[model samples]
Target: MGAASLVALLRYSDWHSWLGYMQQPYLWRVVRFSLWQALLSSGISLLIAIPVASCLIHRSFYGRAALLQLFSVSMVVPTIVAILGLVVVYGRSGWLYQLFDIHIPLYGLVGILLAHVFFNMPLAVRLLLQGYDLIPSGQWRQASQLGFSRWTAFRWIEWHYLKKVLPGAFVLIFMLCFSSFAVVLSLGGGPKFSTLEVAIYQALRFDFDLNKASFLALLQVSICTLFAVVVYRIAPVNRQDVSLLAVKRYSLKDSFWAKSADALALLVAFILVIPPFLAIFDPVFSPIFLLTLQSAALWKAVLVSLQIAFPAALVSLLLGVSFCVLARFCMARRYLALLPNKIEHLGNLILMVPGLVIATGLFLFLRDLGWGFQSSYWIVVWVNAVMALPFVLRALMPVMYQQERRFRAVYLSLGVRSWSRWCLEWPLIRLSVAQALGYALLLSLGDMGVIALFGSQGLVSLPLYLFQLIGAYRLEEGACVAVVLILLCLLLFYGSTRFIGGRSLVKH
Candidate 1:
């Protein structure tokens, strides 16, 4: 992953053209719009997420469990599929128009912001809600005994919790929105709204301007790398519990007005998050659904998607395990302590230079080498695996590191070695491992970035196939494919987490 990405970015140097490209007005627009949208998206998501998480934490509601689950779902919905749903609801001719004579003009920055908030706000809420679990019950008891009003309780208690988690969540969401591709590509409308990622794609794919694409890819990498360094310097106030299910929280009593406010927040979040999913699935009742489902091409795409997903997941786990093992080894020793963190940051290099940029860089490199279409499949697989590495490592590292720190000496003295050691360890690490594998698989399966560059007659994954269906103006077929993709992702994620992880995972 490191070699290919770095080599492709650097090997074919055209510094003079790159300098000229930097001066282009189009380049500045892409850079300015990319940063602006990411900033807006992150700021807006955090503001909304705080109140929603507060509602979930303080107010007991009838459908709270289901609503929390739906928030998690928003995080996993394929980007393109989600955009399709957003378009169906917000486009000039969509549900809003037909039902209420309202049009959102979802072809530019407005649509991009809506799509980003839909995906990210719920995620931000989930992360924020977890922060409350880290707060001791004693604090809540203290507030109760002090006869603290809701405002006072929030100031002393909830704000403290939010302060701890908010920065990390904002950084995560900002990186996501900044490096966003599909949302901007599908909803950006045209050049006026294009981001760096979209501009890179257009330069390489349509304009055939290799110099411009390479320059843009390098520029994108530079900006992300700067942010990654800054993020590393700012240590997180707390380590969040990564859980798939809704967290169980201790209840807080609210006054009628407070309860009303919480209810209003929940209602807004529901209206924002749920409608697109419902809109996308509405095609299930259409007459053409069966026709779309029965096509051999559709099945072939599914098979291809699975083939890519499995191998990519395995490879991700292998790399992640290697990094964790090395980090654990480093942490166990005194002198090599800093190396462990530095090693982890190396895995994060992929985040700075995203899969799309890498794909373009390699596409440029491979074209120079005269490689044919057959290479695209393996390239996609490799990139997907690498792309998934950071996620896999996040899931595995803390659990593995904690186990080693606590148990290594005990095991050594007891002569608990090899198979026995694994037996002792499996139950402790299995859930984390299973979740990591599931997430990696889901990411690869739903990925549109790598596949977009490499997709051909022989290289169609499900996302690529769905993109083609939409491109041909086949909305019914596109929705069918989208539905299948969503079902496949959800079922696979559930199966991996439930069966492999041994039970439904609940954190506090």
Candidate 2:
């Protein structure tokens, strides 16, 4: 589907007409806005994440575990819920302005940046902190003994660890910011501040300009693909953890300063995180009528989400598993090893090609393929299954790799075939498989792209249903549905928690 879209795009000659429109002053302005906003959002998120990660690694203060958990809480919150929180907190009649008389605009580039940072910062902090936690405490102590200042210690130890993964982290965050859809579609007040994804959406859904939309989609995909490739190439692939065995210790010198810095970092994290929780919670408890719970349409949407999510999760897991196995086998075949690192690259590439672009591309491709079953439902399900591939890979591959390293010899001696291998290995790696399924469910449940493309009389997922509620000015009902959606996510998260508890059953 994606390949056909690219092929079709290349065949056009009046590239001049499309290129000219792309180069138009307004489009250039939009591109510049998206670029800088993404950069700044990623920067601000990293800033918020780093100090907190540093403090957590260095200091074992009160509620230290809780603080770490706090940092992690935002990692799984749905984007739709996050946006709703932003609306309640910073919107026209939000509590902030009511409490402080400070009216902040929540509908422009600043709002978009805040939302992006909100969604992305926790991921950055967690990733970077994993690096920090891996650095040996001995290195820190040795540096301190050598009269190395805080900056100097960071320069030698933290800097190197951070540098190893920084490009990849930045690239991932940038790709996320670049392809932001729900945030832009909801909070982007006007077309002037739109992104390429939003532009593609507006072109197709609102303006109905097929030629212009297709042109813009091709351009967006090209730019994003190039950036993804460059960033992946620049990122380091191998660097072992140094702090894995580091002994935890309380620092003696300058405890006051460390405490103060830690407190400040906690405060900053608090401000960034607390609002969304409050926003999501406040509406649920507020004397708002719970009409959505009574509506048959809401139940239908829930059922629809379950049907799509279960199959999508299973299918995505299968595709991800296949990709992982293929990559593992390809390691032995020198010629195949020389091919593009598709397994590693495809996820980010998919992210680069925004959901709308993929949906549009898939729609066109399916239309061209002359499939007998041409319902929009199949398109949504297939694209969604593909979209869930990245989450599955991220969750599953690490476990699979670890298992292969630990038990490869045992399995090789037994001459385990494919089905037998799965029977043995799946139990050990069930945690990762479960995590992948949970992530796939959460992601697809919230997605609006596929439904938007092949939208039908009866088709509705939670996000699409939420969109309809919001469109009809049923804010209170929308909030209720949002709460239900969030609870479903929490249920998934809780189920994943069992994997952590059962980790002891699987030997490394």
Candidate 3:
């Protein structure tokens, strides 16, 4: 079938003519620009996050706990909300540009990088900090007692721990940037700087070039699948310990550098964290923001978002539960679950598929079906579900494992039927379910991809509507909507995690 498709592609069909454009120097230029920007952005975010994470882990200061919580909150804010703030702050009319009188623009590759960093830096901090948590407190004190310098202590103690988690972290960040669609779409000033996902969107949505879209989608899938497999192979094995230690505390010595590092981490964390939150609030007092409270369209968009998000979250939970069960009970088929006894690979695989690729492929399949439901609401729901499944799986996997181990003898002695057992086991798994559903809802709420394709004049999710507001230069309304979106996502996340992670995860 691929051979036939290749022949058809080479036959100079009208739609396939765009294949020549793919090989054109200008297309490669866009590809080169995207690659460089993603690499630069990911590298810079990791560099900044690593030291700050180290400081957060290695020392204690006033408000240290508060700072960590602040960072965690930043990690959950939607990309649209964060990037909207970046635009308002760094764009031509923004406070910084006007204050500095700099004519430079933050609307192209530079804008994309800043937005990516703003969205991703907190993730790096959290993951690396978690890595730091894995290391015993004694290791650091031992190195200090041995008279090791800061560099020596980090090189000997922290470096090994960092190494254990670094590959997974790097891969996670890379996949995020690689598949990054919303930021690139919003910040990319024109077609000059675009990722594969954006390119696929242009092809499918604007040009209606299905052949070209299919080819691009295939290319993306092949590249991402191979990259995921390679990263999974090299990822450190079973590096995360199941046991949680007593929270270790540290007091920074009264040295100039120690003081400097803490201050630096605090400053960086604050700068990265604060503006988006305030930007959202700033719009609330505007006339348009006030008017939006009475607008039927605003309420409609909210209802649409809720409808998509709820079903998507439910689907994600169901899929995640099935996956968890298959991995747990079907021991021999466990290898079919991707990485055995490890959470990283399965999560990475789900994360690696660029949102655009999945949306494009499904669009084509539906188009070929010539069905009436192609542009219906269900497509958005399914795409959101798929996008969210990985996160759901990640949240539930550990909880499922712990529950299984905790109740193994009890279940075995009772000869619990696999499907019926869940009736009795649901309470133990409820927290995990909550966490999974919470993440799924957030994912769906923030999604702008599939809906962008299938969305019509009559159908718009909140993210798509916000994009339109930005396109139409309704910044204040966009900001207000952004605030509303963030709040809803936070509520879902908080409620779910509060239950899922309560005594079970904490007791560990």
Candidate 4:
């Protein structure tokens, strides 16, 4: 990665090109808008999340778990599908226009902000909810005995921990919004709302300007590194505790105002996430649906998507498990010290290197090497794998380490070595492994970043095909494709999670 960064830097080191590009007012506008929108998106997401999280912890109602699951889905719901869903509701001739006769300017900054909030606010709510779990039950008991009002309890008890979580959550959502691509591309409408990621893609794919692409990638890396450092330093980890169910404050009676506020916040979150998803299903009944299904191009794109997803997922799982094993081995010795921690951190550090930046670097390098589109296939896979690595490690590292810690001596004493050891361990951790792999597969399948830059007519994946369909305003066809993509994501996600991991022995 360092070598790629340096190579990108050196290739774009010509001061004249830098000065000329920097002189363009449009570039500065993009930079400023990127920062401004990210700030707004993060700030807005947190503002909304705080109340929602509070309501959730204050009261556990029916469907709350499902709502939390839905929140998790927002983060991984295939960007193009989410964008298409958004367009269905907020576009000029969409749901609002047809039903209410309201036309939102859904093609520009407004749409961009809507899309960012739709994708990110639920994530903020989930993260903030975790912060609530960190609060001790004793505090709630004290509040109950003292007859604390909702506001008073929140001010004195909950706010204390929630504030600790705010900085990390804000930075994370900001980084996601800053590097956003699919939303910007679909709804940005034009250069007025483009982000750095979009600008980098334009330079590489449309303009074919290697120097410009490299320069943008370098800038992106520098900014991302600053935020990544903050993330590392803050290191907020909000784990669930069983005590979250304890000591519901008896003093906190539901007032009409509190009920109204919680209802509104939850309604806002529900409307934000559900409508777009439901809207995606609109075309399933249309005549174009069957036609799209029969189209060879659609099927071919599906095949191509699988072609990328399978290998990319395998590579991610292999790399993640390998890192966990090595990290655990080092931890066992204790002399190797932070080698384990460093390895764990290095695996996640992939997040700081945005997918497009990595692709841009690889794209530039491949061009210099005279590599053709044949090898671009592998490059896309490699980039997608790297992009999913952090998630895979997040799923695997804890479970993998725990299995080793609990079972290592037993397995060693019983002479479970090599193949025997792996077989023994496989079932124990396959649930996590399958989940991680499933996530990687979905990520690779849904990716528009690497493939967008490398995509050619001959190399179209499902997402790129759907993107093209949406771009041409073929709503009928795009809806059909969106349904297929969503089904594929869910099917594969569960197939791996349930079938590969086997059903949980724990009775629900």
- Top TM-score: which candidate number? 1
- lDDT tens digits, residue span 93-172, model 3: 87567788765467788888887777678778866765675666676566656776556667777778887767666767
Q: Per-residue lDDT of 377-466 in model 4, one digit per residue for the tens?
A: 988899888888876876676566666666767876887766787788887778778878987998899999888888987789999999
Screening candidate 4 with a backbone cut-off below 3 angstroms (N, C-alpha, C), the clashing residue pairs are none
Model 3 lDDT vs. the true structure?
Answer: 0.69
**Residue 508: error of model 2 in Å?**
15
Candidate 3 backbone collisions, by pair:
431-500
Clashing pairs in 2: 134-242, 134-243, 135-243
lDDT for each candidate structure: 0.79, 0.71, 0.69, 0.79
Ordering by lDDT: 1, 4, 2, 3
Find the number of clashing residue pairs for candidate 4: 0
For model 2, the local distance difference test gives 0.71
Q: What TM-score goes with each of the models?
A: 0.88, 0.86, 0.83, 0.84
Report the poorest 10 consecutive residues by lDDT, candidate 2: 499-508
Model 1 clashing-pair count: 0
